[model samples]
Target: MLSLLLAAAPPALAHHPGADLDKMMGSEEKFFQIIDEPAAPPFELADADGKAVRLSDFSDKIVVLYFIFASCTDLCPIHSEVIADIQRKVNATPMKDRVQFLAVTTDPVRDTSEVLDAYGPAHGLDAGNWMFLTTRPGQPDGTTQKLSEAYNVRFEPLEDGQQMHGAVTHVIDRGGRFAAKFHGLRFDPLNMVLYINGLTNNVRKPAKPEPGWWDRLKVMFL
Candidate 1:
């Protein structure tokens, strides 16, 4: 049975990994907005500990980025939950170290150190690979909100202390390339895991299988 399966398997094609991912996802994934930009919008924000963190800091790793505020009662929590699910799936694999998760708060003034610190663990985000970022001390309150606009997302302030915004998960490849966006909270987490796997897999060229190994195995089984 093993020999039959091996003989029946289709020949592996040598193609660019990024192009393969785009082709596969273009047909199967309706939620992805693929971007061809050379660089993602840059920002420098502070984590819960008040240490400055910039987008460039993660230039060596793939970045899974999103925007949210702790006080948002509608889509923000749902978005965080979705991201947490994706993070869990990513962390389970060897690709964990090659990826980083970042959540930028549009309401930096309200999401203080304490709020940013608790938001992750509360939503099941692993602190080892995830971070919730906000404006550093002395930065304007609307700084992050404007940055969100640059990423093609909007966070409108409402009279009720909640933000009006759409949920978009941005994928930034190493070296700051804006790769794609997974829109809304409904995209399958596994699809994202697979996408990140493609990016990481592209870093190393895979060895080709030995020629005629399938035929040799089939003859042995016969």
Candidate 2:
């Protein structure tokens, strides 16, 4: 059996390193309101630029995730913009390479790579660690349904071209463990950084892709 490994190198397009955050003391207190939940379901989706991304891809650090439907005229954009601000705060602090941001779209039909690519610079989202991803429709189990099911997020389309669902942000550790859930749009970036720092400095193992058949064969004693 042929075995392969995805060795670590400096990440491209969305990786930033080196930070010093002495400014976030006592900021972790507000996180008391957010509850830690079970890990989100395992799934793989494609980024706007057409590269496959899995939960494992972010096994290197804390991952910040939020769901938004790109075509919505208002709130979705504002939510993503807040995420972009979080990205900026983390990047400018002592937690640069220790975290990443994932902005996933619930609406794929109108959220193609071109569309996502266009949305970034508008909200200062073009930085490294900011990823825009989507699952093309008809991709195995219906894209929206599958992803929503994975996160336990609900989205029912309305007649006037809007969706009815809760809006929240998720923080996941390298092992894909759900760390916290921020229930609303307003939250502190300092709290997030402190949490990410906790995970990065204390993680037991760096995330690795699940061993496939070949990987198992390579380790077999037979």
TM for every model, in the order presented, reads 0.84, 0.71
- Backbone collision tally, model 1: 0
Counting only residues 3 or more apart in sequence or on different chains, how many pairs clash (N, Cα, C under 3 Å) in candidate 2?
5
Clashes of each: 0, 5
lDDT of 1 by residue, 138-161 (tens): 987689989999998998888988
Could you tell me the lDDT of residue 21 within candidate 2? 17
Worst 10 residues of 1 by lDDT: 9-18
For model 1, the stretches where C-alpha displacement exceeds 4 angstroms are 1-18, 203-222
**RMSD each, Å:** 7.6, 13.6
User: Which regions of candidate 2 deviate over 4 angstroms?
Assistant: 1-38, 136-141, 203-222
Give the whole-model CA lDDT for all candidates, comma-separated: 0.80, 0.62
**Poorest 10 consecutive residues of model 2 by lDDT?**
1-10
